[model samples]
Target: MNTLSIVIPALNEASNLPAVMGTVPVAELAAAGWRTEVVVVDNASTDDTAAVAHALGARVVHQPERGYGNAYLAGFDVATGDVIATGDADCTYPFDALPDLLRTLVDQDVEFMTTDRLHRTNRRAMKASHFVANHALSALSRTLFRNGLRDSQSGMWIFRRYIWDGLDVRSAGMAFSQEIKNAATTAGYRFMEVPIEYRTRGGEVKLNALPDGMANLRQLFNHRFRRQGGRGEAGIPAQKQRSERYEAV
Candidate 1:
């Protein structure tokens, strides 16, 4: 059976792990011939994040460094699956939609699949400021990279494990979300976005909208120009292909 590694990065998210982990359709995935390897990266949290994840049947990986990308990279290094899926441990992303998302990934032959949380988002799930920031960043990303991505900051993404080595993602912070997506698209991978239900978070929010948004903006321009100067591609890969279908949930 094929294996799917679900990697979640957590920092003081002990209160939210139960709902996040419980929503994962393990039995449904198993019936579809996919074994789920749930990995929760403990980002040096003071609380019981690691213990909670372990008790909830997740393989806990210790990431002492306190960066979103650092935790995810650490988890990815240890994940033992053919396919990799990523999300946060804050319970904002939809884990119950994974089974159907996995089907879309396979059926469409997509190399990288990211979720869209902005479309039809619940008002209570995200603050107005975040929604606006996301739209602005996504607009800049689409304009700079020509990737046609709607939600560049979405935390949930499903992709083939092998593609990780080829993509050149460098951000170590919140900018990691856009960087990874840009990297995959720039590497000529088949990409698609699916709409998913976003929910109100269960724990304290860690993001500083102004600073993080500014950092992400800088990362975007820097990445685009750096690639253009070094590879002469200008963020647009010659072999890139858009997915035939956009599966909506």
Candidate 2:
């Protein structure tokens, strides 16, 4: 079976960990020919978050930095799966949808997948902030990267290892989402977006759209000039992560 590394970027997600863990239908994912491993990226959390995750058989990693993408990059450095899965730890995205998400990645033959939370099935269930930010980011992505994005900032994404070729990414915050989307357009890599429901965070929300929105807009222009002008080198294949040993899920 091809391994799947499910990375959840969390900050003080202690109370919600058990709930999120329960959302993953283990049998469904296992039956899909995936050996699942969950990696929790802790962003300097000040709680028993690590202990709780370890107790539930999840591998926990801490990043010295404090930001969504920073935690993601830290987890990326440790993943060993051929395909990497990233979703927020705030219990907004349903982990039970893993089967569907993974299926789209393979059936579509794409290296990148982003989920649209406002898609008919989930829009009725989403918070206003989520609906607005997704719309804003998606529009901005289309303008800058020309990727025809419907949910550019969605934390729910699955990426094949090989798509890293011809891409150089350096954003350390929420900007990582736009950076990847922009690179995909420039590199001409295949990407697909499917719809999923969005629920409110089980705890305090870690995001502020206005400021993050500005950052995202800034990234779009930066990427446009950098790609259209003679700036970045062609993408290179992503290297295999050093941690080959299985960490408990």
Candidate 3:
């Protein structure tokens, strides 16, 4: 029975902290032959985010680097589980949906799982350009290298420990999300995507739309136009071949 270490990267999220902590089913987790622990990577939050998480039984690691990727990596380095599950702390991602990711591994024996924000139930605040960007990037990723992720920018993901252990997480900022998918494809790791809703953040979005969007576009083009080796073949080892059959996440 392996443990599950949930890495929650947060930045001044004290308001949402208690709710998230209360939402997770820890007793059920322990009963299922699974030990559960959370590592909250506080990205220089001025509030009591770290203190609150500690009160709720989460180990807080302060990551002064100030980026989603860096905070996630900070939490990952200290994770104790065989599988690392990462998600946002702003309540945009449903912590209740975590079992879906765990079930994916049991049922499919796959290596990675990323959530799709375009799920059926929740309403999306997608601007026209954002929708276009999502589709365009998704299509390009499939066409160019078969990354096969419907939502490259999705914040929720569960990854096998070995796959992450073998590779270096070099992205220090938002673009790192796309960069990981780029790296994953070349590495022959099995990929899966589950649909998760994306609601507007309770507070303002931490993201800067024009700049982040442009950065995403640049990464996409780098994948589309740049030499194939970095994004597609930088550090990959041969693995098992893909099967004809598939399971929907």
The alpha-carbon deviation from the true structure for residue 157 of candidate 2, after best TM-score superposition, in angstroms, is 0.7
lDDT of 2 by residue, 74-176 (tens): 7877777888888887888878888888887888888888777767667665667768777877786787667787877777888886665445666778988
lDDT, model 1: 0.86
Residue 93 C-alpha lDDT in model 3: 75
- Candidates by lDDT, descending order: 1, 2, 3
Candidate 3 residue lDDT tens string, 31-145? 6666888888888899988888888899888777688777776777677798888778887777776675587766898788777875445446555566667667667666666
Give lDDT per model, in order. 0.86, 0.76, 0.72
For each of the candidates, the C-alpha root-mean-square deviation to the true structure, in angstroms, is: 7.6, 3.8, 7.9
Q: What is the C-alpha lDDT profile of model 1 across 120-187, one tens digit per residue? A: 54666899889989999999999999999999999999999988867667677899999999989987
Question: What is the full ranking by TM-score, best candidate first?
Answer: 1, 2, 3
Total backbone clashes of candidate 2, pairs 3 or more residues apart or in separate chains? 4
Stretches of candidate 1 exceeding 4 Å from the true structure: 227-249
Candidate 2 residue-wise lDDT at 41: 82
